[model samples]
Target: MSRMNPVLSFISHNRYWFVIIIGGLLVGVIDDNSFLTRAQYALQIKNLKEQISMYNSQYGRDEQKLNELRRNPKAITKIARENYMMKAEDEDIFVLSDDETNNNKENETTE
Candidate 1:
């Protein structure tokens, strides 16, 4: 009687299991639309959602500021004076130099 090789006998016995494992690995890792790709896409979608929510909140704040500017002349004037450095006809504007502002920041940080 001839003795069969142990490796060949083991493989024949577990051929189905080997096929299942290889098929699973191919589906999960080697396919174009695999589990890893799906996971990466899900993470990208989550990040995009967070960015969208942040942008929506910023848009809401800008919309509220626009409404306030439209309804109240005082708010418009305040924004112009603070942002554009505009002055009234009889008002004096004391503009701080960039150096002065940087010095003030340094002093505040030191304090």
Candidate 2:
């Protein structure tokens, strides 16, 4: 029996716009074709590619080292002696630091 205020009536009648905007935002989030989803996919792909390149470089270095070891018996022996702490029965090994030798020379000169 009473006419509503025009502003209130217009807002009440068009309340669906709020629901439409919220629904559109939700749909965009769920759709992988959206811009944000595409950027995330691209970043993941780039990170995987960088990891692959790093692995390939490390593998290449290891392969080169393996080839060198295969070609040189002396290098293998040196590596074994240095890294594995191997010693020949006939040889006496003394480990000395260059700093100590330098300090000894300096002491001798001062004395």
lDDT of 1 at 102: 42
Taking all chains together, the TM-score of candidate 2 against the true structure is 0.58
RMSD of model 2 against the true structure: 7.6
- Which lDDT value does model 1 have at 95? 72
> In candidate 1, what are the lDDT values of residues 31-91, reduced to their tens digit?
9889999999999999999999999999999999999988999998899899999989998
- Name the regions of candidate 1 deviating beyond 4 angstroms: 1-4, 97-111
> TM-score, each model?
0.74, 0.58
lDDT of 2 at 87: 87
Instruction: Give the Cα-based TM-score of candidate 1 against the true structure.
Output: 0.74
- Please give, for residues 2-53, the per-residue lDDT of candidate 2 as tens digits: 4558767887888798779777887677766876898899999999999999
Candidate 2: which stretches are off by over 4 Å? 1-23, 32-34, 95-111
